[model samples]
Target chain A: MSALLELSSVTRRFGGLRAVSDVTLSVPQGEVLGLIGPNGAGKTTLVNVITGVHPASAGKVRFAGEDITRVRPYQAARRGIARTFQIVQPFPGMTVLENVAAAAMFAGGLSYGQRARDEALQHLRFVGLAEVANSNAAALTLAMRKRLEFAKGLAMRPKLLLLDEVNAGLNAAEVDQALELIRAIAARGVTVLIIEHLMKVVLSLCSRIAVLHHGELIAAGAPQAIIEDPRVIQAYLGKRYARAQAGAHG
Target chain B: MKRDASIALVLFALVALLPLSGEAYWMRLGTTMLMYGVLAMSWNFIGGMAGYPSFAVAAFFGLGAYAGAVAQKFGVPMGFAWVGAGLLALVFAALLGVALLRLRGHYFAIASLVVAEVLRELVNSMTGLTGGGMGLNLPIPAMASVDAQARFFFYVMLLLAAVTFTAMLITANSKLGFGLRCIQQNESAADMLGVDTTFYKVSAFMLSGVFVGVAGAVYASWVYYIEPPDVFDVLYSVKAIVMVLLGGAGSMFGPLVGAAAFLSLEELVWRNYLEVHTGVLGLMIVLLVLFLPKGLISLSQRLGRRGKLR
Candidate 1:
C-alpha cells in the first residue's frame, strides 16, 4: 500500500528545548498506525505539527502526495485532514447533533438546514451517538464525550484521521469499545494515526508501531518485534537497568 | 407554535397600545426605551451569539448621528438623511469589524472601546464638518406639531425595533447563527468541524453595528440635537451591554426584557432621587453582575420549572 502520510526529519522547538526532534515516520493507506510514547515524548506535538497547529521547525509533511506543511488548521481540515484534541473539546451549549451538524456544514457543502441535519445524524449514528442526539454536549459523560469527539471528526469526512489519546481516562470496557471503533474506522479505508498510552491497545490495533522516547523515534516495526527489540527496551530504561530487568524477568 | 410569531404578536400589541396610555413625557420615555431595546438587540448579535463582547457601540451610534447631522446641514431631506446615516454606519461597522473582530475576549472589548474613544476625539477635533466641541444644531423640520413629533418619533422607533428584533430572530435560526454559537462554545472545535470562525465573527459584528448606528440616527432626529459628548457617550454602550446581560445575553427576548427593566429603574431613580441616580445605577449593575450573571431569562426559566413541579 502507498504511504498516505510521510513525515521526514520533523522537528519542533520550544525555545531551547526540542519537543519533537529529528522524527521520521510514514503511515500506510488504509492502515492503523499506533504511536506510543512516555509523557512529553512529543506525541501530541507531532500531531499538532501534522495538523498545522504548530509549524515544524525542520521537516516536510506530505499527505496523500501533497505537501501540506504550511497549511492552516482550518485549511488542512478542508483538505481532508481531521484531528481530535487529547482533551475532548465540544460545543458545550449545543446539542450533540447540532455539534456534528456544524462540522458537516463546513466540511461538506451541505449548506441547507435539512441536508446538514441528515448528514449529521448519519455521522452521529455511525459513532453510536444517535440516541443522545438532542442532549447538550456539556451533560455527556467523559466516555460519551470521547465518542462525540470522534463523531465530530468523522463529520468532517476526512480521508485521514489523527486521534490523540482517545482512550485516556476510559475504563477497560470503554477502551475495548474504542479499540473496536478504531478498527472499524480503519476497515472502512480511512487512514488513522492514533497516539495512545495503553500498550494493549497499541499492540492489538496497530499493524505497525513506532516508539518515541525524549522526542525521538527509537524503534518502529511489528508490535511484538518492536516490543522485544533491545534498543527499544534500552530506550525505555537505562542500559544497565534494561539488562538487569531482562535478566531478572527472563 | 414557533417562538418568533408568538413574540412578534406580543410586540405588535404593545406597540399599538403604548401611545394611548401616557403623557408627552412618558411617551418620550417610551421612545428612549425602544432605542435602548434596539441597541441591546444589536449588541446581542455579536456579544450573545458570537461570544464577542464589543464596547464600541457608541462609536457606530455617534457615526450615524454625525452622518445625519452632516446630511441635514447640506440641506438634505430629513428622510434621506436618516437613510444616509444608516448606510454610513453600516459601511463604518463593516470596516471596523474587519479590523477588530480578529481579537478575542478582553482584547476585542478593549479594542472596541479604543475605537469609540478615537472617534470621539477625532470628531471633537474636527471644527469644519462637525463644528468641533461646540456641536451642531439643526433647524427643526416642520413635519409635525410638538405633540405630533413625539408620537411620530415613538412609532418610528417602534418600527425600527421591530425590524431589528425580527432580524435577530431569523439569524438565531440560521446557519450563520449556528456557526457563531459553535465559535462561542469551542472555537478550535468549531474550526475542526468546518466553520470559518473569522468570517462569522466579522459578519455578526457588522450586523450588530448597523442596527446600533440606525438607532443612533433615529435618536438624534427625535431629540432634534447632535453633540459629540451626547452622541458618543460611553454610558450608552454600558446601557446596551447591561440590558443584554440583565435580560439574558443569548436569548431572543432577553435584551427587550432587560431594556424595559433597566428603563423603569432609571425612571424611578431619576424621579425620586435625581442627584444620586448615577450612583444608584452603578450599584444596580454591580449587584446584577454579582448575583444574576445568567440574567432575567434564566431566572424566569428556573421559575417555570418550579411552577411545573408544583
Candidate 2:
C-alpha cells in the first residue's frame, strides 16, 4: 500500500567525495522503478545504501514503514532486502545449487538438508539454471552467471530486490528472458528497484524512470517524460539526442 | 549409502583390531598417530571447514596437558582430568576466538601463531604452577607393564580420534558446515546472505579447542611427563597443519589420511636418513606445496571424477 523502500535525502560519502548526495527516492510496493544514470552517477552507491552495504552518511532509509538507516547488511537481508552485485560476487568452488542454497539458508533458515536443497532447486529453476545445478558456479557462462547472481538474490525472498545491472552483458534473447522473469517476480508481489543501463528495457518494463547524474537525482517521471527532461539530456543523454528530439518535434 | 556404511565399518574394525600384535613399538606409534589425528581433525574444523588458518593448536594442547596434569596431581581421576582440560581449553577458545577471528588471512595466521608462543612463554615463566621450563611429571601406574601401558594409552588415543572424527563428520553435514563453506568462499557474501559468520567461526574455534585440548591431556598422562617446550612446541602445530594439508583439509577423512601420510613419512625419514630427517621432510613439504597444493584429497577426487567419467 505504501512505498516498499524510502530513501529520504540519502547521502553516501567516501571521505570528502559524496558518491551519492542528499537524494530522496521511494519505490512503491509492487512497482518496478528504473534508475538510469551515467558512470559515477551513484546508482550503485544508492543501492548499497538501501541494501545496507554502505551506511548512509546522512538522511534516512525507511523500508516497509520501518526506519532501517543503521541496520547492518546481513541484518537488512534478514528484514527482506536483497541485492545482486553489479560485479557479480562469485562464490568460488560452490555448485550453482549450493550457491542458491547458501542464500536460502541465510534468508529462510530452512532447517537445512533436503528442504533447503529443494528451495534452492526451485530458485535455480526459476532462474533457468536447473540444468547446471551441480556445476561449479565459476563454470557458468557470463550470461548464466548473471542469472545465478539474480537467482541468489531471489532465494532471499525479499519484499524488495535491488537488481544492479541484471541485464548487463546479456544477449537480446537473454535480456528478453530476464525481463519476463522480472515481470513474473513483480506479479508475485515482490517490489523491484532496478538500476539498469539499457534504455529500451527501462522504457518497456518500468512504470517510472528516475534519472541520477553526479550523485543527484536530476529528473523523475514516466519514462517518456524523463527522456524529454532537458537536465537529463544535458547530463546523461548527449546533446545529439536532445537535438534529434528538437528536430523531430519541430 | 549402504556401500559407504560398510566401508566405514571395515575401517572401524581395522582400527579397533589394530595394535593386537602386542608389539610395544607399534602400540606407541598407534598412540602417536591417533593423537596427531585428533589434533589435525580438530584443526580441520577451524582451518579447513571454517577457512581460518588457526595456529593456536599447540596453545590449546599445552593448556589441556597442563590442566589435566594439575588435576591429576590434585588427586582427580585421569578420565575426569581430561574432561577438565577440554572444558578449560573450550573457555579459552571461546574468549580467544572472539578477538583473534577478526584478523583474516596472514594476519589471522600470525596472530594465532603468537597466541601459542605467548602461552608457551607464560608456561615457561610460571614455575610455581607449570614448573616453568623444568616440566611436570605424571604419576605412573605402579604395577603396569610397559606393554600394558602402551596398549592402554593406544586405546585411549583411538577413542579420542574416533570422537573427534565423528564430530567432524557431523559438522561437515550440518548448517554449520554450510555456513562455514559459505564463509570460506566469501565472508562478506555469507554475511550478506544472513549467515552469522562470527558465531560460526568462533564456534568452530571452540570445537577445535575442546577435542585438541582433551587429546593433549590424554597424551600428557600417557607420556608420563610434559615439558612446556615439548608440549607447546611449534613443531606440533606445524605437523598438524602439514597433516591436514597433505590429506585434505576440509573433508572428514582428510586429517586421518594426512596424519597417516605425515607420520609414515616421518618414520621413513627418521629411520632411513636419521642425519637429515628434518631437512628431507622440509624438502618434501616444499615439493608437496608445489605439486599437490590441494593435498592428496584432490588427487583422490580427480580419480573419483575419472571413474565417474568411465
Model number with the top TM-score: 2
Candidate 1 lDDT by residue in tens digits, B1-310: 2776697768767765777975897788888998999999999999999999889888889988888887888998877888788888788888888898878899999999888789889999998999989988876868658888888889888988888988898889888888889888978777766677778888888888887777877777777778899999998888899999989898988999899989998888888888999899879877986798889878888888988955
Clashing pairs in 2: none
Error of 1 at B230 (Å): 0.9
Model 1, residue A242: displacement in angstroms? 8.1
Give one digit per residue, the lDDT tens place, for model 2 in A49-70. Answer: 8878898999999999999999
Q: After superposition, how far is residue B160 of candidate 2 from its true place, in Å?
A: 0.9
Model 2, which residues run further than 4 Å from truth? A245-250, B1-6, B141-143, B304-309
The positional error of residue A172 in candidate 1, measured at the CA in angstroms, is 1.5
Please report how far candidate 2 places residue B301 from its true position, in Å: 3.9
- With a 3 Å backbone cut-off (N, CA, C), the pairs that clash in candidate 1 are none
TM-score of 1: 0.92
Q: Which 10 successive residues of model 1 chain A have the least lDDT summed?
A: A236-245
- TM-score (0 to 1) of chain B for each candidate: 0.95, 0.96
Docking class of predicted structure 2: medium
